[model samples]
Target chain A: MQGTTRTPSQPTTAYQPTDRTVPTRSPDRASYDKELVHSILDEGYVCHLGFVRDGAPVVLPTLYARVGDRLYVHGSTGSRPLRMTGAADPGLPVCLTVTHVDALVLARSAFHHSINYRSVVVHGSAYDVTDPQEKRTALDALVDHVVPGRSGDSRPADKKELAATAVIRLDLDEVSAKLRTGGVNDEPEDLALPHWAGLLPLRKGYEAPIADPGLAPGTGLPGYLSAL
Target chain B: MQGTTRTPSQPTTAYQPTDRTVPTRSPDRASYDKELVHSILDEGYVCHLGFVRDGAPVVLPTLYARVGDRLYVHGSTGSRPLRMTGAADPGLPVCLTVTHVDALVLARSAFHHSINYRSVVVHGSAYDVTDPQEKRTALDALVDHVVPGRSGDSRPADKKELAATAVIRLDLDEVSAKLRTGGVNDEPEDLALPHWAGLLPLRKGYEAPIADPGLAPGTGLPGYLSAL
Candidate 1:
């Protein structure tokens, strides 16, 4: 429920096309539907954050959260990207991407082998969040993003902890989702070959909740986690 | 068996640490071990590749394979990154990263919540691979990387298929693996809190393979896939 609020100024269904969001190849696989982009972004646990450092590109994997039309990424105040955004006057340009591999498509020919995946890419300028209220909301969204309703269950961050953390915000203006689904596309001539061709679906989910050893004796498992 | 050969010039046990490979925040979590890096890279199906374009960073998810201390990424010849690398005189500077989320670490306090994960980041220049022999080997490695021993079972690429694919190579000279493992690390004072804190382990693996409907009747599932 954190990222469900919409403003009148925002696009109703699909995002507007931008130069960077358009793919140079396989344009058919790209989509600007707002629902598709949000679903892909929400399903991911971490995002690969790209930024320029010393004139060279650097990519790092970190936690992220989406709220309405904005995305939030956090780290220690001393982290490189956070520090860079704080020092820059306007903002730090960044590319944030999230991907989910659903299955492996094995074809009769090596050339046709591919993976079925869903991915979302957002290009924008990241600015450090200084407002105390927005920062707190972002932090709660980040925690809840990992596990729904987790923020209310856990102890909120104290003043000292809040000061040590840095949160950056990126508006989801230039965004697009690319996806590939379904079966293998082997050549017709190679259909009768000895190779066994098919789809190997990748399964991912939570196993069981492991309780902390130091947990209080009477603590019970939360309903939100049990439902997952 | 592909990508296992090592040259005499390569390091024995670990990779050399470069300035860009070091993490500015959690230095203790960074590693340069060669085996650790290879194991992490081999387990992933997709990588987030980052490159600078027009002074801004771009990140895309793509399939990749590792040969010895080198990584190969393939795409259509008309792809933006592939075209850019072919045009750049000294090759294109890129950051390739792979990550696996092992578990969700839930702490009694929101500040200590984190994920247990293993990730590898490689910083270097990516050059177009024009040599036919090397490109073929890289393509095989790419297939086998998805499923072990799969390259031999599939039909080899023909001349037309090879002409359509573009391959690029990046040496793993500047590489580092960062990992976060073990249980939650909540504040000692919060140990007595009522919240249930622990790790929610994520399970990922291949399910039963679904055969292609057009497959020859007698074709059986390969032993390598059965083993998985």
Candidate 2:
């Protein structure tokens, strides 16, 4: 995994007594360190964004890109949560999470079997990003996150397009990264059961690019996409 | 590829004004058909669960199983949103969504580039599954959803486990599905650019299962697992 840091470590916000969040397996699973958090976030491009709108909870699957300590999410300005954020008391309370299931863990007994994975959950408020420069930078990061050099290659979002889109920023203040990997942990007694158990790994990658029919006769694959 | 149903059909719930939440999509981009909605949901296993806790929105990535017209989700009974359902007001409102990215639509101009995907969004009120029989059936559906025949292979959830776990039920109602698939639609002007544009196909599937090292003699793969 690629690991890089762009900011100095800062103190995390204090935990309030009123917070009702209850984490499972706190001792073995909790991780709040900054590097660990960013690494997981950087590796993921798609995230499941959860927020409550109109007193009802809503989850949206969307694309996200990280820049420094802030994560940027973009969507149509007409989205419910985005519109609601523009006129709200507390803004939108959101839990944004990214997960990658590394492998499946098959145990001798069904109860003990589980999957090995890496995931990060962020709990905080998401406010709309209004500054044009910041929004432009965030948008560039979004483009580059998927294909490194494309931000400069293609025409940037025009004034009208920018106006039609909505961008939101959430600081990575309260977050946790949980991971599990390796084979199953079967009980000694259950090990003798006549059940076959082990991991069935999961892998995700890109295949050959299929050129669109409209492409020019001489165009070839870009280095960045070929590398992917 | 599986065009199980082509015509549009509505689910059991009537389309109320509130359910028509995001009307901003281009006319060709939105879908309100039941077959389109169910097909998207049935093909997806993981869903983004969004809820509110202490007035803040939280989104979590978790496993979900769909049984007939209902969706099943469970976690520790101590979790905030799960517990919130038992408390006072108009029950907890939730939006459960599932998404599958089919291909990357790489346009000549980056601004026109987009992803081809199938997504289903369900809007409704959620309540705890209080009926014991229903809960058991939902749990079995969950187990079966993960691994088709594992529910029969493994020991079912005992009373103690059931007491400690909390499961919530949300019927499939007021739902919508959106899809975009196929090659990039490059603008005529940008076709002359030297950058390559094409669709990068994405897929997910299982690899061979590795038997647990601790299994005893005669413990071969189960018929159901092998079938998968």
Candidate 3:
């Protein structure tokens, strides 16, 4: 979206799509705008992490948080994938993708059936966050990512818990956001068909919060939970 | 979960986990239960399909449906990934995963912050459905998967439309369902912290469907939309 005249040392608002980030399908829907990619990533709570395992592809759904240009994901200390990511100096090549389905497009022609979705795909090598401070920040960002202000209200990770968790960081460079929006686009002839063609919107919403049964007698729902 | 005493030719209620389906982390949460796997797949509207391209794993989010033991996904015939899936004779090795986040598990310690989620992972090869009748059935199943009774209400696909779309069917052989439910599992010492630790449930619900502005005057809202 912008000129590549800026050196790698300088910070830029736009992402430069590489060969891997470029989409061969619906190319028109792909964008390298950093804001768009960040918005999609922020709206999503979980990401599908794809990596080559024993010559076969494996995808796992896990919680993720985007802080600045870096994406952070944490796992158990005993997790093989996380351990493998930090085993090598260059780290593990990974594809992290987050998607949000806005609506279901019911076109007149069945072939045109599609979903209104916003997705961000990041291609990079994931490195383990060995620094304790960075690890704590990443973990806090992850909790705050799910619900704003909740991190401040929640207790910070202790030494024992921090020692048990492993955090991996992926700096977003080859990033692209693909989005399909609006109503259905039916064929000229199919427009006159009797079938109803439009969008059936989908939304993920927060419901009433349930407090732990072991809560102190006087403890009440936090203000942030009420707002959510 | 049931014993796998039935023959391959006969239907079985339980799924047998191989080396691939077993989880390296949180192995206790993983199950080889067919009913649980099906339930997780059925509840999700989108799935992340991972495949290898240029020796790198790429994950794409797309619509999918589960019928019997077969999972069906369709895309544009011109799509590069979809095209490569059918270009090979034996089909393409894929890891299809569906996840549903039931609640946000907030623990007193940030490291224990996790999600109550149900996810199903199916590892197998996907083959293109060539038969016209089978393709139609698969397409219908995909449509109904989004909204029950939708395929019956909507017009079926025509010959030309079917020709333009490529349907890939993946048989569910190596399937595993992983789920984390209930409240936060915080450390006993951390329970005394001032932070509020509980669950924030998330729900996906349908709003009142809006009719197309270009709809015929007498055309009314579908009954299915009302139920939704």
lDDT of 2 by residue, A93-211 (tens): 78888887766666655455466677788887888888999989988888777667888877778887799888888887677766665677766666676656777776577768898
Expressed as tens digits, the lDDT of each residue in B3-48 for candidate 3 is: 2122232146778878989788777778777777889999888999
How do the residues B1-228 of candidate 1 rate in per-residue lDDT, one tens digit apiece? 112222323466788888889888877778888988999999999999999999999999999999999999999999999999989889999999999999999999999999989999999999999999999999999999999899999999899989999999999999999888888888789999999999999988987899889988799998999999
Q: State how far residue A93 of model 1 sits from its true place (Å).
A: 0.6
Quick one: ranking by DockQ, best first? 1, 3, 2
Instruction: Please list the residue runs of candidate 1 whose C-alpha ends up more than 4 Å from where it truly belongs after superposition.
Output: A1-11, B1-11
TM-score of 1: 0.95
Candidate 3 per-residue lDDT over residues A57-159, each given as its tens digit: 8999999999999999998888877988878698898889999988887766666677788999998889999998899889889989988887887777777
Off by over 4 Å in 3: A1-12, B1-11
Give the deviation of candidate 2 from the true structure as CA RMSD. 4.7
Instruction: Give each model's whole-structure lDDT.
Output: 0.92, 0.71, 0.82
TM-score of chain B of each: 0.94, 0.87, 0.93
**What is the two-chain DockQ of model 2?**
0.57
**CAPRI classification of candidate 3:** medium
Which numbered prediction scores highest in TM-score against the true structure?
Answer: 1
Order the candidates by lDDT, highest first — what do you get? 1, 3, 2
**In candidate 3, how many Å is residue B176 off?**
0.6
Go through the candidates in order and give the clash count of each: 1, 6, 0
